[model samples]
Target: MTARPPSPRAVAGRILRHPENLTESEQFQLKNVPTHYPELDALIRHVRSFAAMLTGRQGERLPDWLAAVRQEDGPPGLHTLAAGIGRDRDAVIAGLTLPWNSGIVEGHINRLKMLKRQAFGRAGFALLRKRVLLAR
Candidate 1:
């Protein structure tokens, strides 16, 4: 019988994709795959790091993280998303990092919209404004 050994990248890929397929020691090696190919590992790290940054509520770190996104590296999807984010860079950063939100403002907006729809052609702007001011 003959057995052909698996390539490190393939082995690592399997370990990365399906850790449940390997033993404890093999899973441990998957964690260390960066040594085999730094670029692949780095790309993975960039993705995970970006995700971690987004999940955090630290607005102060937003500038640096956005710059990292703009950098010519990581996944192409990230670049596309970053470009979209760049359209409202300030707002995106605020959304990602700030602990506060515009829930109150949005609630008011929804109320105003509802009032407008309810009063469409029936009541005038003045009446709508009064209702907006008096509504709970």
Candidate 2:
């Protein structure tokens, strides 16, 4: 009997994970990806390169990478991503290269939003304010 193909979500998880973290079976499946879908090979390369640049703070390479993505017959989604990045090139580069981030502020905002949703129609602003201030 033919072996069952890996699920799309499983394949995507494997692709997104660091190569060193993959198990033997996962590595084998990843190795066969290019054979099953040649176009995905280019996508995988581009995605890994982008991930490397983001993690390594190599924002200087964004322009060249964008150009390569636009020039190659890569997946259409990558072309869209390239265009979006082009629109906010400076901000994107700064975010990628700089050490500063608004993660804390964003987390607080998310928590506040979730609290508000949970208390919707059940509490007044004063109670909500107290909850926000007292939240750990």
Candidate 3:
């Protein structure tokens, strides 16, 4: 009986994350499977770029990133993301460029969410709001 062929996924995944581990035939097979992970690959790259921008405080690159998102032949979600960025362009830019961070507000919001979950069904809106406002 003949051996079943190796899954393209194995070859492709290895080639991407650890090319040195693959044999010549497996490496050659990678050329055939680029389309299999195209969207995932693009997502990784775009996310890395976005993280770099925030970490580096390179707000000026927002426009270019938005442009790339709009132009990429990616999933529809990307276009929606581009539209969101466009709508809040100024605020996003400010968050990137300014030393000020929304971390404090976000922390408060997260605390409120946790408190709400803990108080859900046991309390009314008034109590929930009071807890959120009064909590340290």
Those runs of model 3 whose alpha carbons end farther than 4 Å from true positions after fitting are 1-35, 112-136
Model 3: per-residue Cα lDDT at residue 96: 89
What TM-score would you give candidate 1 relative to the actual structure? 0.44
After TM-score superposition, what is the CA distance of residue 74 in candidate 1 from its true location, in Å?
Answer: 8.6
Weakest lDDT window of 10 consecutive positions for candidate 2: 69-78
Say which prediction, candidate 2 or candidate 3, comes out ahead on TM-score. 2
Off by over 4 Å in 2: none
Which pairs clash in the backbone of model 2?
A: none
- Candidate 3 or 2, higher lDDT: 2
Cα RMSD (angstroms) for every candidate in the order listed: 9.2, 1.4, 6.4
Give the residue spans of candidate 1 off by over 4 A. 1-51, 60-78
Per-residue accuracy of model 1 over 34-106 as CA lDDT, tens digit each:
6655555646555555556666666566567668767746556767876887788788778877788889999
Tens-digit per-residue lDDT, 85-109, candidate 2: 9999999999989999999999989
Clashes of each: 0, 0, 0
TM-score of 2: 0.91
lDDT of 3 by residue, 1-136 (tens): 9445458567436544545666787765654454565774565456657777887999999999988888788667767887998999999999989999779899878888899999979999999889877888
Q: How close to the true structure is residue 1 of candidate 2, measured as C-alpha lDDT?
A: 100
